[model samples]
Target: MSDQSSDAVPAQWSAPTAPGGDPIEKASGENFPVALRLLPPRIREDLRALYRYARHVDDLGDEWAGDRLSALDRIEADVRGLYEERREPTDPVVAALASTIARRRLPADPLLRLIEANRWDQQVTRYETFDDLLAYCRLSANPVGELVLHIFGRATPERIALSDRVCTALQLLEHWQDVAEDYRRGRVYLPQEDLRRFGVAEEDLARPTATSQLRALIAFETRRAEAWLDAGAALVAGLSGRARLAVSGYIAGGRAAAAALRRSDYDPLSRVPKPTSRQIASAWIRSVIRGWG
Candidate 1:
């Protein structure tokens, strides 16, 4: 959607180096870190490549100094070059993605969708409904789960449907956790309709601590998010070997995060709620034993 032509782009945009830091290191902040060390080396590396590409795309959308829309357009072009045009991507992240695409025979649509989500971020600051928020999750969060399925050779249509529920739940939990932060960034992930239903105003999100109404709204959303996560628990039972463990870890991490939010009485405006290692470990064990009861 950027009006700038390819010719107008700066030279650095051609093959942008990673701005800084290890993209993999960011896993610590995620609901579940992909590319866990316990997985086989090849799977770990492939997932890392995917994570790096995703992180780079997110950074360009969130933190890039130049035209964010133009930057996102360039990343999409790089992905298309690797897939549609069979051209080598100049950007290292896309280059890594190229290898994953070839090895897994992955589709370009999901990758393109992720880029599209970032583009949407530039223009859309508020969602009208919970459905609209889920629509955004389909573009931003679901693709990572799909890509992981392809890497593990488990991407059936049914499994993908299940994964979407899990991914959307994770995305919602993240939105709940970062409500204040998102407000500071001039965006609001909470649906406007839900805000009205709970008597919460947009200005309420800017407060240093959540008001009673805001806390009640978050509680309602938390229950909704937990239901979505539970809907995807069957995904763990459908897998075997490391694939099963990995998927279980994702569900466990979501459960742990949800618990942390509840412990905070769902008040994200005061302080961000985070799951401790012990909570995550306990959830993982229960997931393995109970398998989403």
Candidate 2:
């Protein structure tokens, strides 16, 4: 367990240590772009609020070295503060997020779902089937897009449905990339049925190199992710202006991550694949000009 002094310090939420003196510096640590520079300042701040909320909850679940569940309990209280006029937003991240929630008239459901996802993480580690995995994604990933759409004033039922597919695909892409590391954490995101089908046993994940069977299974999952991604492509085509660009970035990110898996030939245990900067840039441009589909 980490020492109390360190655990008690909210260094991540403290006034930024960066020369710019903005906590936005922490945004760079995100897997996806939270606030693109080209976006309007107001829109960027809105996205940043969502990003910060997600990021802090993620840290409580994954990065916190001690007493994580207790920390989460405290965070839950602060989240309630956002809804109550009499309660103060005691946490910096929560306070900033409260502002966004107020400004956009965002629903509390998606944000609450995100917090619940991390709480679920405390008890659940492995999934039994693809459907089960998707259920987990509904909690862990889908809320992010739903919240973003709300921020952008684009959370129609149709768009939220497509966004779910995209978000779920992105989550799967990340899981495929982190298979080995996740295995080390005693958590396997891969569906057990798929593992059995491909003859890729759990022990294969602990190896320094991926077995042929493991490679095959990763390839299969990659294709499944691709299909989900393709299903959401229409989401980008349906939007305009900065919302269009933001969704385009998401589609391109999924493509780039999927490409990385292919480039590694699915040998994730040996070394996880990642898209090059050039590949990401190209995909972003293509997504803009050619559309996500």
Candidate 3:
């Protein structure tokens, strides 16, 4: 409902879909359902539109080969086109987002923040501290939860705070999972201070298997993420029906992914650990049951 961070929105232009995979499927794999069959048609379509917008931005940020900043700028212009100009957009994803923006009255800021996060990604490759990393999450991840709340008509200050915790935790988990892959791409999401504290060299992250020190560092980081995730799960109690189900899926997915990481002894360097279907189902059921309390 409000801008939680004071990130300046930049103006610029280029719209290229990140080349590789299906955006919806890619989003689904990241820990939550975009559009579930059981949701009402309107909500399902709305969620699909949101996912497309997110996927389009993420693909450009993560995979676009040329001038990513300008690409982000182009997308942001289209987003502003939807809200500010009230005109059709050249990019189909941003074009599709028009109705959802009108229907939900979603702010341009969150969409702009998503683009800002990617722009930050291009410039800031390594985080020097945990606090710095959280700032990045404000740009990169928390806005999605904020926008989701607006979509469900549940964006309140209290709920937004809780959602921020859940979103940031999920982002941290993703970074931990992609340590090796990120290193290869010339980025490191793990805070430099933590690496120094745990004696984990950047080179250690690129190893085929994690060193003992690296595993220890990951274990420590996983614990930090789970604490925030558990605290945020309390948000589910305040929600009901489909909104509760969707938020519960997010909590469950985060917990399940954390469990998977633990099962691998927090050695993400060996392989990117993922929650199995049973784990996801079990966590989701537990979350739903707990929410009934």
Q: Best candidate, TM-score-wise?
A: 1
Arranged by lDDT with the best first, the candidates are 1, 3, 2
lDDT of each: 0.82, 0.79, 0.80
Stretches > 4 Å off in candidate 2: 1-35
Which of the two candidates, 2 or 3, achieves a greater lDDT against the reference? 3
What TM-score, to 2 decimals, does candidate 3 have?
A: 0.89
User: Per-residue lDDT of 1-293 in model 2, one digit per residue for the tens?
Assistant: 34444225455543222235433444322235332566888988887777777777877787677677777776777787678775776677777788799998888778777788888788898899999999988988999888888888888999999999999998899899989888887789999999999998899899999999999999999999999999988998788878888887777878888988999999889897767556766788877777553
Clashes of each: 0, 0, 1
Candidate 1 colliding pairs:
none
Spell out the clash pairs found in candidate 2. none
Candidate 3 residues 1-293, lDDT tens each? 02221222222322233235333344523766422445687876777788778877887888876667777777887788777786567777788788899999998898899899999988999999999999999988898888888889999999999999999999898888888888998999999999999998998987899999999999999999999888887888899878887888878878888988999999998888987656776888876766531
Measured on C-alpha atoms, candidate 2 has an lDDT of: 0.79
Deviation in Å, model 3, residue 243 alpha carbon: 0.6
TM per model?
A: 0.91, 0.89, 0.89
lDDT, candidate 3, equals 0.80
Error of 2 at 199 (Å): 0.9
